[model samples]
Target chain A: SQKIEQNSEALNIQEGKTATLTCNYTNYSPAYLQWYRQDPGRGPVFLLLIRENEKEKRKERLKVTFDTTLKQSLFHITASQPADSATYLCAPGAHGNNRLAFGKGNQVVVIP
Target chain B: EPEVTQTPSHQVTQMGQEVILRCVPISNHLYFYWYRQILGQKVEFLVSFYNNEISEKSEIFDDQFSVERPDGSNFTLKIRSTKLEDSAMYFCASSEAVDYGYTFGSGTRLTVV
Candidate 1:
């Protein structure tokens, strides 16, 4: 069975600091990985998608690193603000596979 | 930016009753999907629809479940006999291609009482 894991504990970060989160998977090699931000009572909003061949991807103040060898991916939010607080989810899937397996997600709280 | 839209933000239903959740995917998108999230759990895939037929479905999508693109634009998920365990937030998503990032709808919160 494929499994995806993330930190169960919520990350409390000071505003303007960088917040980092990790997502680890087992028993699968996905061709692409996606990160999403989900606010309470709302559906997930797609943030970034990185392929296995890409070591790093950046968008504005967000950065994501994919290390297929370690079966891990790191997500970073630089200069975080209070509005940046939300639960972040990571989903990984194969090229032909239509469904994406999502992790439970890691919550981030940016304190002012 | 195109967005997938789902109707009936929340619905409370009795057990053993039938319920149909509806969605209107992006016009230009060819692939549509149904996913659900139970309370605090991960989003689970229910089924995928393309060209007016089901392409793939999960075990969770048993005989009790059925999907349809009735009028070419509206996609629907029908539960024959809803069970208490069927309560979850059902989301509709669409993508231009299988590998593309999907745009998800706000979701319909179904509560089987």
Candidate 2:
């Protein structure tokens, strides 16, 4: 079965530290991968997107890397603050259409 | 910034009843989508709409599920017979172009009883 996986455990990091999360997929290659920040009881907010051909993408304090060969994408939050605490979701899409397959998000808790 | 708006932030429906969820996507966005997330589960794509018809839909969008852009501004998802498994947070999202990041509505929590 096609699957996208993220570490189920919550990442506990200190303020000002860099928190990293990983997403791995199997059985298919995605044309692009996207990251989203979701607060409890709220919709997921767009964070960043990286294409299969691109090595990395950055936006403010966030960075994303896509490695098609490895079928993995890494998301990093730099200078993490308490406000950065939320669940991060990884969504990867195929070559056609607008459908996105999402992984169960990884939670990050930035301690003040 | 523009937003995708959804109505009735929360709803409780009787099992076997019909329900319609409404949404107003960003005015300029060309692609509209519906996604749902069960409690503690990943967000799942239900259907995508473009040019007044469904562009693509997941298997979860069965005979009981249907989508329509009834007018210029409103898009709706109608489930003919709601089931317990249908209870989830239904989100409406829109994107200006293909592959663009989607702007999602806060979501409607549909609870089936």
Top candidate (DockQ): 2
Candidate 1 regions with alpha-carbon error over 4 angstroms? none
Full-model lDDT, candidate 1 = 0.93
Residues B5-107 of candidate 2 have per-residue lDDT tens digits of: 9998999999999999999999999999999999988899999999888889999999999999988999999999999999999999998876888899999
Per-prediction DockQ, in order? 0.77, 0.80
lDDT of 1 at B45: 89
Clashes of each: 0, 0
lDDT of each: 0.93, 0.93
B83 Cα displacement, candidate 2 (Å): 0.9
Question: For every candidate, what is the interface RMSD in angstroms?
Answer: 0.9, 1.0
